[model samples]
Target: MSPESLRGWVKRDRIDRGEGGPGELTSAEREELTRLRRQNAEQRKTIEILKKAAAFFARDSDR
Candidate 1:
């Protein structure tokens, strides 16, 4: 099975065992994930700004 499929099976098995299951992210893991998500949001905002700037320059050239 593919890695994705394997991961899914593992998650399902964990849930079946009545463990924390998919909610098992530790304090450190959760903090890191939150930081990464925030960083990704910032990167997305930067990309959006760059796209708008590029479009504005392109429109100016077409004038």
Candidate 2:
């Protein structure tokens, strides 16, 4: 089975066992996740900007 499938099964099994049923993340954990997500978004935006700059530079070089 794919890793995604395995992760889904594990999540399902936890819910079935009633062990906090996937458990709500702690405030700290939630904040950490949010911070990480924001960082990831920022990184992606930076990468897109860099890619555009590179493409522009490459076109200029070809001229």
Candidate 3:
């Protein structure tokens, strides 16, 4: 592997093993963060859709 890529992998491994430094995220934390971010985005999209549907129905009722 390239030296830079190897270095990055080693760094991540160290972080995952809790040997890198303080305040560094472990693999589990990173995965959870990714999952939460995806879920948040999905929830935001659903909220937007619901809001638009509510507005459309309200407008239709006035017609």
Candidate 4:
């Protein structure tokens, strides 16, 4: 495909034709995405802590 066509294809495939995919994010949307990502990271950390605690207790009980 030509460069122009390839760019169009990439935009369509990766960003869904600028319909709010990776290549397109407004300032407000970017902030929201950052906040959501932080929330997700915090949640994952909490889950890991809980899992470790559970494993520790389970192991102690097995002895």
lDDT of 1 at 6: 96
lDDT comparison, 3 vs 4, better candidate: 3
List model 4 lDDT by residue over 1-63, tens digit each: 699999877665655434655558655666899999999999999999999999999999999
Instruction: Please report, in order, the local distance difference test score of every candidate based on alpha carbons.
Output: 0.82, 0.80, 0.95, 0.80
Q: In terms of lDDT, which candidate is strongest? A: 3
Candidate with the greatest TM-score versus the true structure: 3
Residue 1 local lDDT, model 1: 72
Q: After superposition, how far is residue 13 of candidate 1 from its true place, in Å?
A: 22
Give model 2's TM-score versus the native structure.
0.64
Candidate 1 residues 1-63, lDDT tens each?
A: 799999977876665566654567655566899999999999999999999999999999998
Ranking by lDDT: 3, 1, 4, 2
TM-score versus the correct structure, for each prediction: 0.61, 0.64, 0.73, 0.59
Ranking by TM-score: 3, 2, 1, 4
Could you report the Cα RMSD, in angstroms, for every candidate shown?
9.2, 9.6, 2.0, 7.2
Q: Which stretches of candidate 3 lie over 4 Å from their true place?
A: 1-6
Across residues 1-63, which tens digit of lDDT does each residue of candidate 2 receive? Answer: 899999977765655556443565544566899999999999999999999999999999998
The better candidate by lDDT, 2 or 3, is: 3
